[model samples]
Target chain A: MKLTDTFKTAIIGLKTNKTRSALTMLGIVIGIAAVITMNSIGAGAQNLILSRVASMGSNNIFIEPGPWSKRMEKGSMMQSMVEEANITSLKREDAIAIANHPLIEMAAPFTMGVGRIVYLDVDKKSSYSGITPDGQKINENNVILGRDINEDEVKSMAKVVVLGFTLKEDLFGEEDPIGKIIRIQKTNFRVIGVMEEQGVQMFQNMDTYAFIPITTTQKLLLGTDHVKWIIAKAWDEDRIDEIVSDLRLLLRERHSIYNPSGDLAKDDFKIMTQKETADILTSVTGVLTMFLSSVAGIALVVGGIGIMNIMLVSVNERTREIGLRKAVGARKKDILNQFLMEAVTLTFLGGVIGILLGLTFSYLGGVILGNMLDLKWSAPLSLDSILLSAGVAIVIGLVFGIYPARKAAELSPIEALRYE
Target chain B: MAKTTEVIEVRDVRKEYRNGAIKTDVLQGISLKVFEGDFLAIMGPSGSGKSTLMHIMGFLDRPTSGSCNFRGKHIDSLSDDELARIRNKKMGFVFQMFNLLARTSVLDNVRLPLFYSGLKGKEELELAKRAIELVGLTDRSHHLPNQLSGGEKQRVAIARAIVNNPEVIFADEPTGNLDSKSGQQIMDVLQKLNNQGHTIVLVTHEKYTAEMAKKMILIKDGKIVYNQKVDHRRFAKDGFEK
Candidate 1:
């Protein structure tokens, strides 16, 4: 039999019962749609996070004062992630050394503490970070009023502060408050600048902060010689790994750690470049996408079973028709091909509809999610996903359609004709 | 005298059905020859195996023992697919229930056999039209089966049967579901086709219907009680009354 003829016959059979055919296709439609939606949303989320990370200047690296435990070398990969050392060994000298490197643009040693600041009668509690003018520049914190603290202030251990926009609003309120005296931790300090309006960056709320010189913060507020963390900006994008290795060697030599081998666990500090952070975030979202996609794959399997169930019912219902066809000289393969083609056509059509629906839904979903999360969503639907879904739909049809088609083909004409 | 060609021949064919070891012999040691251009009817009461015998002869069922041959080929020796090919090219069937596909137009229903005959669309359409014209359903060729009358539906079945221009036609209780007027019209159509030189094996319970055929057999309890030529045949005359 010609494939076209068999296809026509299959179409006729399906058209005879349109409601059932559509209902049977719904399962496949939903399955493919779910898979595509999951993939699209995953891509959109990855884009949002990666874009956010890139906005923080790709050359920046964050250094935290935490040494890995000696057990890291013998432990699993995940176990080596534990790196909260109790000893505060990171000093301001380490930041200065790192800042002097040829590849380093600037290294800002920063320490933070929460203190009550009394300006006139307003006694407000706020978090303050002690960093230099270089730290303010690298973080994109532009001083809109007055002047930023210079390197001379750090050498003189000057007790001066810069107020963030929201903090200035809370403390001074519509008044030009630069050069005004504020009490922090029972010590008097003059506000040198008011920074421009800055919101959250890298999960840190930047608007409600007050800044002081790192030496003044270490000597007066908490009375410690150690700095908490340092932010390092590279001179250029290339050879970041070399700079990181050099920083590790320099720190190891200064701190007198005797290990010659470069083990990250033995280092006194943990450094993560913005790219590494973005990569980790991407891998995490990738796992989530894969997990959700597997769930959608289950839906496809269930849809295949739905096709099988409906095909079996159709075979039972059309016993007499099958007998009549056989009597009229339909070979077993002809009958099988007819029924199988019916199923494949159904799923393939459903796959097309599903791809369109999935794309539309994902586009809408990206917009909705972007509005809710306050981030720009740029998830582009990929051709690989479309082709993958189309192929899956056809395969499900063949896998599920085979049994029922075989049953119809193997029917004895006499028995089928006589079937009531 | 010219010798007749045996289109189908059976030698002591037995068809038994086993229901959990309880055997029922539907056709018991039956032997027969169907000649080309022959209109033969096997008439019997219900459960007398007339339909089973016709089915065996028509290659619809296999015998439990003995041999049945069609066109010098043993029925048991041919594969099901090979038999299906033969049936498609050389055989046609008309059932009493008028098994036309529901929701399909008369033309497509008639064209079904040709669909499997591997004919091109144009040829299939032309042959189906000719078959429908022969069955006198040309006017109703585009009508769905549900829209057709009982008599018209039977005519559509006849059209489907002869669409492939088979060498032989099998009619099992062709008029059993129709009124007497429609039955007379159907018998007339069959007789006209027989006259035009199509070998026919018909199954019927009605004695009057059997008499219209050139040869008749009476099957009683899985065995042929008697076989003879019809002496008086009734034709579907104008305003014919039974």
Candidate 2:
């Protein structure tokens, strides 16, 4: 039979029973939709996380003390200094040493203190970060409206503060706050600059916090010589690990601590590399997306089964038709192609509709999740998701469609016509 | 008899049916020959195996024993593909119920055989259209089978049967489902085709219908009781008197 005529007949047969055709296609539609939606949402979450991490800095390594290293070093159930040695040993001197290392470009000592800001008629609780001028470069903090504090400000112990972008909007409204005075606890400091908006990073919003010189903050606001933590940057991408190791040795010597030096097996402070963090993020996101897409793939399998089942039923219902076609000289291949084309058409239509629906769902879902997470919602749909889902649907159709088509084609014309 | 005019030949054709473990014989060593341009009819009571015999003759069923040849080719030994090719290109069929694909247009019903004949191009479509027009259904070509009258549906079936210009056309009780007027019209078309040198084999229980053919074969209990040529004047006057 002519291919066009065969297609026409198949189409007419499907269209004759519109509801049955739609019900048959429903499984495929749901499967494609679920697959595409899961993949898109997973990709969106991954993109969001990577941007959050990138905003922090690719060269920056976070040194968080780990429990395993502390336990290995102390070998005790309860020890006070062991835990403190593990965490608090990451101090301002280590930051300066890392900064001065041959492989290091820049680093900053920073301490964070929390206090209520009171001005005229407004009072709000906010984080106050004490940082050197170099911290600005490491954190990518840009002054949107006012100047940032200079190195001279830190050296002279200037009693000046820089407001984060959001904090300025909250405390000063439209008014210029660069020269205004804001009270931190009992000490009032002059605002030197309003830092640019840095959205939100990890758990802190740089836009909401105010920056002051580390020395002045240590003496006046925090009331101790100790700095909260140190943030460091690498001069070159290749020398990050070498600089970190050298900085650790220098800090150990300067502190007169007798902890093993190259003993990550019994380390005092933990150092996590940038590549490690990136790998962890990629692996976690990959695993999450795979898991979600597998569930969607299951739906596609069930949909394929649905199509197979419906086609089998159609073969039964159209037994007489099959017989008639065979009698009129339809070859087995022609019969097979007719039914296979029907199956593919059903799935292809379903896939088209599902992609559109999935894109819509992803957009809405991203907005809802973003609002709940308090982050910017930008879940752009991936074209790969649409194409992949379509490809999957077609494959599913072909795989599940073959058996029933073969059954129909293998029927004997006389027996089929004679079927009661 | 012309040596080159034989259209169908059967020799020692035997058929059997199985109902679970028990077997029953349907056709017992039957043999027949049909010449081109002849109108032959097989008539029998129910359970005489006339339908089975017709099926074997029409190539719809293979005989259990012996061979049937179409245009001197041993059809009994041919593969299903080869058999289908033979059926598509060499033979046409008409059923008692008209067997037009319901909900399909008259033109499409007529064009079905040509579609299977592997004949492409506008020429094939025009041929199909001409066949429908020959059946006086040019105006009703677009109407579906259900929308056609009994006589019109029969005409459409005739058109379909002749569209491929096959060597033989098989009609099983062509008039069995139609009223007398429509049945006569159908028989007239079949007779006209026979006169135009197209061989036709019709199966029927009605003597009046069988009388329309040039030769009549009667079967009883899966056996041919009588096979004879009828005089045209006598057949026109009163058909078989039983």
Q: Model 1, stretches more than 4 Å misplaced?
A: A52-61, A68-89, A110-131, A136-228, A234-238, A256-263, B238-242
Tens-digit lDDT track of model 1 for A340-403: 9999998998899988989998999999987876556899889999999999999988999999
Writing each residue's lDDT as its tens digit, candidate 1 over B40-105 gives: 989999999998988888788889998999999999999888888888999999998999899999
User: CAPRI verdict on model 2?
Assistant: medium
Off by over 4 Å in 2: A55-57, A67-86, A111-116, A125-128, A150-160, A183-190, A202-204, A214-229, A248-265, A366-384, B1-4, B232-242
- Report the C-alpha lDDT of model 2 over A125-192, residue by residue, as the tens digit: 99998988798888878887778888899888898999998888899898988788989887899987
TM-score of 2: 0.89
Q: In candidate 1, which residue pairs get closer than 3 Å at backbone N, Cα or C atoms, i.e. clash?
A: none
* Interface Cα RMSD in Å, per prediction: 0.7, 1.3
